[model samples]
Target: MAALTGLLFLGAMGTANAADGFQTSVPSAILVDYDTGSILFEKDADKRIAPATLAKVMMADVVFAQLRAGKIALDTPLVVSVNAWRRGGGPSGGAAMFAEVNKPAPVGELLAGALVVSGNDAAITLAEGLGGTESQFAQMMNAQAQAIGMTNSEFHNATGFADAGQVSSARDLATLAAHIIRTFPDYYPIFAKPNIEWNRIKQRNRNVMLDAGIGADGLQVGWLKDVGYHALVSAVQNGQRLVVATLSARSEKERVEETRKLLEWGFQSFRQRQIFAADKEVGRAQVFGGAQSSVGLAARGPVNLLTPRSGGERVSARVVYTGPLRAPVTKGAEVGRLEISRGPVKVLDVPLVTTEDVAVGSLMDRAIDGGLTLMGDSVRDLARRAMAKLHK
Candidate 1:
């Protein structure tokens, strides 16, 4: 009875903690640090709910990855098959891009259709262009999601505009968006295109945050009856970028406003600090006989530290080397790590290494050192024997 009562009390406490942390405004929501990939906030982020139009982000990922790899060029032409036209076209027949089957469209305009107009036809066209089929393209998307560490995501189809069991979580979407921005920065600008004119058809962007004062750019908006409304929004301000995603919104305007509010709250509440710069010499190590007596150490990139903006919070840094470094090390060899902390909570871990090499001494130096060591050992042995006799 006593143990059961204790368990009940603990369960109640857990529920209270979750209640405080969970954002009830949306069914699922997540906010993250784009620079460091740190999750600042999350609520029911892994419930495996419907992804709505937000699924297009994965499609965008597939297309952009292929584009970056030189597997396909922007002007590459893709033939619109009957399958893509029928399934991917606008709302009446799958939100079709009004693309004609058996007609050729450039991969770039099709991407604009998929991203800007949310045309199902464009998605299927790009998928077929890259994966040879919509189903196969979805497989590629799932594979890419897994590779980028999105554990709670699954792609049932190429376009996330509509389909049952095609689901992802808010946290996963945020993670995916951040990965796209980081991995395919070259093509990320496409997401920010406010309007695209193709075949004399002009479509405007639906993401209001793009024009909002928050400096948001490059993300997708999604909606469907089953999933309500959803969007993955990202913004960069003063060199700091953040990604936020929400699900089950009541309306498009609500999702946009809430996303803006959430982003503002996050940016106002927290700040990213550069704890250490990569490859910047943190310190120096002694060299044996090189032209320089010592070598420098630093990380490869800036070690970013995210902290609350209230100030007075303690942030510490420590470096870990790759053991005792050998001589003749290059100027940019990675050597160690710098661990940053706020009290007991770790904030950042940066690598530390040698900036230059210390060449080993010459043959003459080695010979003299060997002779001195031999003489010293012989003298020590004789002294030990003398001491033993004296003790005896």
Candidate 2:
């Protein structure tokens, strides 16, 4: 009876702590390490959810591709077509840059307006400029999504709005955001725009992190009654970058708080460690026929791992491979493997290879050695048999 009471008290305490740390309003969320792609915390991240304006990340991908290919420039002026303006103009769906039809806006200004103010008109202009139509631009978005290995996402339009079928999972959104951060680093600064200037008009960023008292620098946010609230927030601190994606948040305040809590937990709970330095000499392998009998080998992996930061010793390491390698070893030949473990968990299995070439011995030398070995073994066996017979 006493043990049962203690158990109940422990369970209650655990529940209380979880409640304190976790939010009550957000329906889905994910936090990840931007450098290593480690998921620190997640809740229903794979479940399909509405992307809302967060779909703009895919749109941005297409635009950045054009910039990288030198097909477009930030200062290039794009003419707004009637179709783009009409498609983007709506009530309470997405903010518009109020671009006039047939008028031109700088590519950079449109990008800023899309990111800072979540402008649908700016996105449509970009889509038309890059893909000739919003529908075709969506194809580019989906293709890029597949290219980046986003399995749980599909794009129906260039802008994430209240389309009946436009949707993406939180995990897919996080993957897309990570790709943007890694692939188009230069354009990433646009996400940090607290306010943007276009056609002599200024609009403030809808992302709450700009003033949410956190060190939020880049990313986007969205809200639609059907989709609730969503955001993809990214921040870098102390050289570590973390991306948090929240979906179906009840309110803007909840989205900001939930993002902060998730990021804080990730940075505070884990750390990056160098388990094996790249190309550092790890072991040696014997060469069958070579100038040297053996050559030094080193690990072939990054030699670093992200793990819990709570003061643990260096991982236990062991060499795993068929050693005493036979014959002429080519320099940099992969031969062995290094297995590293922290406690019972294996951190990494790194491939080890020869650091330098080893030439095989001459055929005459190999023949002579084989003959000597065979002769010595035969003589020893015969002598042992003869001695046994004499003793008998």
Candidate 3:
């Protein structure tokens, strides 16, 4: 099937990354606008790596889902097994909330432990309590991951224990972070707080940059000796929030610097621009056997983007849909997408919907539309062949 594509050429592209020459050395990284989910910048974003403690973001997400569903309350008590204590608590000599062995801790405290303190013990306890076993709880995590669109992520344990299967990409991690903040607004404070005390043990937020200012509010960071440091950072400047996921920084300082640099650059280099106003027709999608040959398409809301602040950028716009849609299309039905790209990076993608309903056309109209479609395709093919021959 031929896709309906509209090609557009915009003004001069700016120096946001071109003239400024922004580069990242982190093995895998992605910068995203939280509101629009735009890929502002990416470097090997899909490369999978053992996420270490970064996996806890998903663990917290599963627990949050349980809470949101009323399956568990923040005050619900979960017992810390010896296995959890031995492997994740003080006995393991890793970051832990120091939850006592065999003692029951409240779900809220455990969540605080896991998120604020990066406590493996608290995480395992919640896993065992909610799913009956850490391994089983990992299944719950996987399900939640899929439901919320963390496509390139997997889980093996509640605490980010070293497992070959426990892996995710920078983009997936950023998606997880954005999902958490957006879905669980009430519970999000735990991720930003500087400290949470559990079992008489106080641990500062593992995210070192949380209090370092620059509007760094929430998110998580992780490190494994083998994989270096991985972090998911969310920050806002001037009311625009950006989520950054970076992996394989050689040191904690490097992780903090690389992510912070990206966030600062994102805030400084981009400015919001309105493209299509709400309810305005963006383009038209062809209709087969309809009252009209094509249906007008518009976005439900104003189409806007955080584009380069300086000058016009080289942008390609396309109103893309799979087919000349079937007849009887309803108004406001999602029909296609308005894709805008800056060079190789897709900066904006908004859902395009039918601006008005279209009923089935008469047989004569249908026949003419069919003929036109056939002719269009044939012409396109012939043009491609002719161009190929000319090039040769």
Candidate 4:
């Protein structure tokens, strides 16, 4: 039994190392593989900081949900209130859509203005129209954040206008970006538009990567007095999409340059390696008191890793489970974990599940298995005692 466990450990050690060789000028940043939720690189990714305009992502997400549920329509007209005009419209001296006071605008146009040009007025109008007040809309944002597994984030406003206690992490922002892309495909193209014309004024998107011709697409950009510059840039190359979130850079140029470098490194340095196919047997575990002597273990989905382009074949993996596993075990039950590593650094860990059911053993089989398990425990105890005495 000990030898079998050792072999499982050895088998799991067959994967490449995820190295942290890249450096960035930004204080907080993260790069993720969009398809697999893999963290390619990170620097203080979970450190909560003011999100600036990036908070608009949640604002859009809430509105998008409403649209999807038929609670609102794209052409739903919103009446611009005085609060919206004063706080986010042209009067506040920040990013504004110049929304006319007391004038009605369609929801589609406001969405375009907010997503394309980061218009604060458009954000406020949408929030008030949907939630009856900006404060209520903020509650919706917080509720949505909690539902989406964004554990370390909070929302206080619709426009992300530098309010105290409004904070998010680079990782959380990246998660939001990915969610928007995956959930709202119909509305995502608005992010790619370079500019939106409203009230005779044209404002361009702050995300310059959209025009970089590197398969870049829609996301968000943000800045505040103390938060510096921040942006979430996502692009696809050769069927692979990568999202890079940056925060607290010295300038917009720094954010763009650092993000570009990180994306380039991700594309150039690593390639995806398939460890196991979906539902394919990875290994087997001894099944005590079951009709079958052993049960096959497999992953619920395809297991893939982003490994160094060169020498990626030298990776290792280990299958770890507390055993001998007692049955009856149902199919798809999580029984173990597959830990992939390279040299000394661990890269990925995925759950190992049973591939098929294992029925409870008959009475005679159960008796024999119980006797065997007792003998195994006694031997393991003796081995531990021997090792302890040697150490003494």
What TM-score do all the candidates reach, one by one?
0.69, 0.70, 0.90, 0.80
* Candidate 1 residue-wise lDDT at 216: 93
Model 3 per-residue lDDT tens digits across residues 176-215: 8889999999998888888987767666788887876778
Q: By the lDDT metric, which is better: model 1 or model 2?
A: 2
- Rank list by lDDT: 3, 4, 2, 1
Candidate 1 stretches with Cα past 4 Å from truth are 1-24, 90-94, 161-164, 274-302, 311-392
The lDDT values for all models are 0.70, 0.71, 0.82, 0.81
Candidate 4, 58: how far from true, in Å?
1.6
Which RMSD values do the candidates have, in order?
10.8, 11.3, 6.0, 6.6
Model 1 alpha-carbon miss at residue 16, Å:
17
Give the Cα error of residue 372 in candidate 4, in Å. Answer: 11
lDDT of 2 by residue, 97-184 (tens): 7777788988998888788888888898998888888888888988888998788888888778777777888778888888888889
- Worst ten in a row by lDDT for model 1: 1-10
The 10-residue segment of model 2 with minimum total lDDT is 1-10
Clashing pairs in 2: 276-303, 288-327, 289-360, 289-361, 290-359
lDDT tens digits, residue span 1-392, model 4: 44244233333323221243458989998887888766677778889999988888899999999999999999999999999999888899988888899999999899987878888889999999999899999999999998887888999999988778899999889888899999999988878888888889988887787876667888888889977999888999999999989899999899878888888888877777676899988888777878766788888999887766654335567777878788898988998888766566555667889999999976755665775666775553444445446757
After best superposition, candidate 4 residue 226: deviation in angstroms?
0.8
| Range of the 10 consecutive residues with the lowest summed lDDT in candidate 3 | 11-20
Ranking by TM-score: 3, 4, 2, 1
The TM-score, computed over Cα atoms with residue i paired to residue i, of candidate 4 is 0.80
